[model samples]
Target: MKTYLPSTSYEYATVQKVAGTTITEASDVLAAEEPLEIRLGYGPAGQRQHRTLSITMRTPGHDFELTAGFLLTEGIIRSRADLTGILYCPDVAKDEERENVVRAELVPGLSLDLPRLERHFYTSSSCGVCGKTSIDAVHATSCPVLPTDGPYLDVAVVHELPARQRAAQALFEQTGGLHAAALFSPAGELLLLREDVGRHNALDKVIGAALLAEWLPLHQHVLLVSGRASFELVQKAAVAGIPIMAAVGAPSSLAVQAATNFGMTLLGFVRQQRYNVYCHGWRLVNQQPAGGPDKVA
Candidate 1:
């Protein structure tokens, strides 16, 4: 396993706490949000070139993994072999811009399709989920069909994941302002937890971390999101080949469709003793459909 480098998650802010009748001033911690610029560097030896890929509003750290995972999910690059090196640019022309930019050097001969990439942003913080509208849906290209023969999970184990994910949410506990995504083993062990201001970004962080650890094609594992499962989250999981995805909140309409079409087992409203499996029910051992004869919408 790769040892993840620790990153700071919060900054101090002054606030007023209200009681039954009195108000007390207090200092509180808040999740930090910042813009990160992603640049892709490619071509051969002396003629290497760099292009601004994207800039996103994100929490300040785990940046390299975020960019890597974003590129992969966007179909820009595949495996770790596609990268020669990744580092935060230390020499921006402006002093304040230095640490906010990361340059990913791609291996020789590979090229980026700019027109296709333009469909994503031309690269900006306002870049939508797939660069169309707000981060509302997954790009069709990002989510291909997933494997049907991935893994089986019991309903009992599915219910256990949200609590496990919640236990590792240190930043959320402190600030309550960030969304989280966690990767877990089929046995319900937490593998990785990534927190972010946006739900999509959090999933990207987790997938990116898995990629760096050479743990891609998560066929036998589960992904538990602290928030609702959106199409973007399901797409990220499908791209990473995770067989199951559970959400503490709920699944969006597009998310349910995507999960059903992609052969992924998606569940929502995971709580103490029950959870609703949205689709691909065959993968849940000893589980049955809830509604007796509800018509398929």
Candidate 2:
């Protein structure tokens, strides 16, 4: 068993702060961000193939989990079994750059659709995927439609999530510039949390941790984000089989639509003891019908 600890997530910077007319030298904590290149190794024993899969700007910590989560969400690898090992590249010339590169070695003889992966990586980098095409691509992946059965959440429990997630965010509290993703039980017990400068990276770390722990198909838990929900985040959660996703901020239209299409319960503005349920309201206990007696609008 291996455990990954976060590297330096924040750094100190000296700045001058002006209050009214007075200026004073002060030290500020800034969230660290660096480029992490994820490489992949595959093929058979004798002749192995290696390629750079992605290079993302993220806070330097939880590098392994970030790599694992990125591969899983991209549909590059399905399970932990798909990977033989994940390690930082040791061939870098500089010490600072050593942890910036990681290699996820796939099981020998496993097949990959390289062209499709290239297309996905290109579209993601360019942000040029149309809404319909993006949703359709999600449907084309191994991700399944979420179950509508249970994990019935209590409104009171949901109200406490934002505060709880905030309190547990050590990096956010220090730097005040990080996003967080948290997993919680139906009873509002915080299960796992990860923080990073990038929202998606934070989520990938959480999902990667869950995958390492063999906790896939998170249909029985609720996921909460410190920021607004996006289509990419929803797609990742759907791929991980999470039934409920709540964000402290608003959700994009595409996020709402994708959640609806996936049969997931999406909640937004989850603070101050209130929230708006965009889709699948039936999963919330004691939720009243909005439009009329027969419907929940």
Candidate 3:
């Protein structure tokens, strides 16, 4: 068993706070960010087609989920059953290095496309692997264009999602420097929540877990992101089969465009019982007729 260690998600650091005429020095716990190398394994049972997928900076914990989730959205692994096993690489030279690298083993007779692995484009914590080749690149092979009849999202439920998502963010409550991705049912029931210093990493963890729990193409679910909705984040959600995505911040221009292209409902500034629907407002249960909304959702 890997022995228990103190929290590595946050570390204490001393900083000076400058006032009008005084300088106060105190310790603060900042969210931890470290490099996590995600590797993939395939080929015959005895043969290891090991290859490095991508190395991203993420908060500690949920390393395997992050790896699986990344592969799922990348159009590599389609479903949870495609995953054979995921663990920290046994080749770590030191104990502390164990958490720095993760390897995912594919199921028997299954293998990854070597050329597709080249598409592993994430190189940092801020940006995900959106190479901007084309709008169609964001669409995964496993994800057909979302139909118009997936799930219904009420404006009231959308407004409540941010508060509920905030309540479930334990790490964020402590560090205030982490991003969160939460999954909710069509009825607004919070299902799963994951947090990380990287926005992309947070979505990866949740989608990875859902994939394991056999919950792909979460057609009847709503995804709530704690930060701004980016094209990459929306792309990840769409890959996971999520129909509606609500964000507490603004949606980027590309993000709005992609959501519109995918026929997914996208909501922004989802707080205080108000939100803006950038695209696919048809899915909002509070939307009005050809006229205006009765009360303006």
Q: Rate the local accuracy (lDDT) of all candidates.
A: 0.78, 0.89, 0.82
Residue 246 of candidate 3: its Cα lDDT? 89
lDDT by residue (tens digit), candidate 1, 32-64? 888888998888889988888888888877888
* TM-score per candidate: 0.87, 0.94, 0.89
- The candidate 3 region of ten consecutive residues with least summed lDDT is 122-131
**Colliding residue pairs in candidate 3:** 217-241
Highest-lDDT candidate:
2
Best-to-worst order by TM-score is 2, 3, 1
- Residue range 109-222, candidate 2, lDDT tens digits: 679989988988998899755687788877887687677678799877888999999988888877899999999999999999999999999999999999888899788989
Query: Candidate 2, which segments miss by more than 4 Å at Cα?
Result: 1-7, 288-297
lDDT of 2: 0.89
Best by TM-score: 2
Query: lDDT score, residue 87, model 1?
Result: 94
Candidate 3 deviant stretches above 4 angstroms: 1-6, 119-133, 288-297
